[model samples]
Target: MATFDEINVDISVVLGSSEMPVHQLLRMGRGAVIDLDVREDEDVSIYANNTLVAKGQVVLLGERVGISITEVLMRSPEIRPMRTDGPL
Candidate 1:
């Protein structure tokens, strides 16, 4: 497992949606709204190595923002259901 300091986290923030690229992005100025892949009222998921690890609500941290972890999502082990039938 990698420690916090050992990882150069590439964080992604999803809040809305947009279909523009670099050329259009350059045209964006102050107050420009760029949509993301998420929606409002939906719990944002935190991913590590492309796997979900936690869920949280968005919070304002002065100039920047952060996720206030609401729930912790763990990687649950696979379960094979118990058999109830006997050999015939």
Candidate 2:
């Protein structure tokens, strides 16, 4: 069996997203704030290796920030199957 300790995965937390014109984006400087499309009470999406794995909430511990996992996402085995058919 292979040990999992040797593996590394990149984790990312997406709170929300926003779209803007290139001119507006280029005009931004330090201390710029781009509003996201999420509310304060909304759950954030957590991704592992660029795949959505779970959802969580943002937390603050002392002066540092953290994430509190509220739910875990699992893949349905029936939905994912090896495609032996010819490519489209």
Candidate 3:
């Protein structure tokens, strides 16, 4: 059996998203700012192999940017339950 530590997965930290028309996208130029759905103080989503694994916040270290993991998520039934706050 192979060790889990030797396995590799695709990890991504999503900051935000935005929807725009093709015309509007084509009109974008250098220095353009397209607003995102995420707020400045919101925690970003962390995905591993396209699955939500954790949440984190953005931070700046000296001259580079990094994500500081705030919570470690699990994939249990209780954790994967549907939200009761209405449709996403």
Candidate 4:
């Protein structure tokens, strides 16, 4: 088995996303703000290697920004509780 410390994963904190026309995208300039689909108070999605792994909210430490984990998103079925007695 591979050690957790030896595993490498790319993490991305998605603030929001939007779709726009090529012309509009090309017209973007400094100080221009593109509206995102997320709300100010909503938790942001955290991805590991492009896969959703957790949810978190943004925080500021002095001048630096950080994310505080709010919830963990699990995708593996093996992590869930198993049924034994009988099938439904």
Q: Which ten residues in a row have the lowest lDDT in candidate 1?
A: 74-83
Q: What TM-score would you give candidate 1 relative to the actual structure?
A: 0.51
Please give, for residues 1-88, the per-residue lDDT of candidate 1 as tens digits: 5566686866564454568778999999999877777777788877755666778888889999888888887664664335689763
Clash totals for all models, in order? 4, 0, 0, 0
Badly placed stretches (over 4 Å) of model 3 are 1-6, 77-88
User: Which parts of model 1 are misplaced by more than 4 Å?
Assistant: 1-13, 16-39, 79-88
Q: What are the per-model C-alpha RMSD values against the true structure?
A: 9.1, 5.1, 8.5, 6.5
Instruction: List model 3 lDDT by residue over 1-88, tens digit each.
Output: 4687899999999999999999999999999999999798999999998999999999999999999999988898875768899996
Q: Which pairs, if any, clash in model 3?
A: none
- Which has the higher TM-score value, candidate number 2 or candidate number 3? 2
Model 4 lDDT per residue over 11-51, tens place: 99999999999999999999999999989899999998888
Better of 2 and 4 by lDDT: 2
Alpha-carbon deviation at 75 in model 2, angstroms = 0.8
Error of 2 at 9 (Å): 0.6
lDDT of 2: 0.93
For model 2 the local lDDT of residue 46 reads 97
